[model samples]
Target: MKRILIINPFGIGDVLFTTPVIRALKENLPDSFICYWTNERVRYLLEHNPQIDKIFGLSRGDIKKICSKSRLRGFGALCGLLRNLRKEGFDIAIDFSLDHRYGLISRLIGIKKRIGFDYKNRGRFLTDKIRIDGYADRHVVEYNLDLLGLLNLTPPASRNLELIVSDEEKEKARELLFKAGIYERDLKIGIAPGAGASWGRDAVLKHWPPKNFAYLADKLIEEFNSKIVILGDAIEKSIAEEINGAMAHKAIDLTGATDLRELAAIISCLDILVANDGGPLHMAVALGIKTVSIFGPVDPVVYGPYPVSPKHIVLKKDLSCRPCYKKFKTPVCLRDKECIKSITISDVFDAVRRLL
Candidate 1:
């Protein structure tokens, strides 16, 4: 049986974008062994996927943490990881990292066929590559599926995002919701007021004002009697609290309360998710839940909900400088992110109402 390794050391949204590729690989090559290489934080997202036979997790933070103590030990750790991969005897490697490091590692490990995108000539070690300036004009999933042409494979008709949530996780999520005073009859609407950690300190640029979220939540409660539940990492607890503080109605704050798997489970229980462009937005799409996502610098066409439908509503400005985030970079904004800030609560509320 042929062994294949897929390399993608990105955040949740970027990593999730590659799911269609994984599904296509397993369907076309049922007997082949498929392994994934990702960061430790998102390992939970892939652990339950039956299409993936094994997973290797090593983050840059892991090496940096070791190096801070001893450079020699850090070197040894990297070498040890390489040794494990070399022993795997992988015949093919599909690299989605857009970096030369993974391609070089695949070659050093004796992989014959290395395929990836040649972004800005970074795929020098790749045996086969598609040259591109950046993710524009088409969705990222389509770009990922295009890589399959080198292997003489065609994408499946169904290109939905795949996320496998276990039965136990679903039960745990339901229990948590029950404890939060949410029941089966409640019209549950989840809101993520903070942008995800992918943007780090600059995440604020992607955020629609917290006051807007507060107003929208209150409006939803008044109109639909919706139970507002806040979702985010622990670091974003303050932002969630700010939204709750501004709103006359109260919301259950679950920031940093659940792990990644539980987060997915909680999202699955929601009737609708209103969030900024980030991981949770994509998670809701994968779970087949409706989403009304806000996009600012990033182009929704390139990174928005896959298989766009009426079920998913995207809110974005049509300014010329709106989609400044292109080619994997976001230029400094002179307008102070008016692209996202200009979006009013009424706009989002109307979109959510239409979806509901």
Candidate 2:
């Protein structure tokens, strides 16, 4: 195919997971023009990807403006987006996310070859459906690469994720940290205190408590003299405040200030990153920074630290109900979300100490 479109319109971590396929496609078909479709918010992450030639992003703010209070407006806005997408003239379309919306978009865009998984009843819209075998147990990167099987391409053995951050961005990160009182001799540890952007309270399922994070930061500061920096998007600014507020020695909050490249640059300078199962954790791992990953409702086997990386550490509470979040979109809790609640500060403290 001379032109290919890869669709993954969701969270930052899921989009990052698709990079392996992007890398493989470029390696196997260097001449092809690849366009990745993702949300407007995450456009920065993929903007610099060398494997892909173009990016098709749907701006959330424009959608909000078009469909603010009307159902018909929402439908019309979607129609406009689909109509615009159809004009792109893609030779093939691959949907990493198993959403029928993406599949239907591919179909309506008139791509001759469409590929996606059979989950969520999306096979009806796809010309090819790859059956997900024991998917819940497999790493998402593997599953993303499997879609390449449709093109008669074997999955590459090396699944090391890569994101290119410019040297200028690195300088920006150092300047930011320096202004926050981080000296060259100081040990830098990053804390991701929140999950990806969510609209409602159900987002609580994926987050560790702020107090626990505060306690862990305090311990790191007291024991190692580590300079704590809380990193996240604007949505997480409150979370940073909550964590820093609870701690005796406050962390430097960089939430809402950094974009994706700057975020990667910030992560590149860190000695270690401590976070829940989310985007920053994957980014840190990809950047080759040591990380202490905290697991609660999600299964670490599928989404934890890359097993091959020796520097990464995973801290999890082995509750029977854990991996409690299904499809990671919502929770399947029995009653209380003890999976997250049961993971104590002491548990995380011990893990951080080992990393330090």
The stretch of ten residues in a row with the least summed lDDT in candidate 2 is 195-204
Candidate 2 Cα deviation (angstroms), residue 99: 2.2
| Candidate 2: pairs in clash | none
TM-score of 2: 0.91
lDDT of 2 by residue, 52-113 (tens): 88886774444666677886887787787788777788888988767776677788779989
**If scored against the real structure, what TM-score would every candidate get?**
0.97, 0.91
lDDT of 2 at 105: 70
- Which prediction has the highest lDDT against the true structure? 1
How far does residue 138 in candidate 1 sit from its true spot (Å)?
A: 0.5
* Span of ten consecutive residues with least summed lDDT in model 1: 193-202
Per-residue lDDT value at 295 in model 2:
77
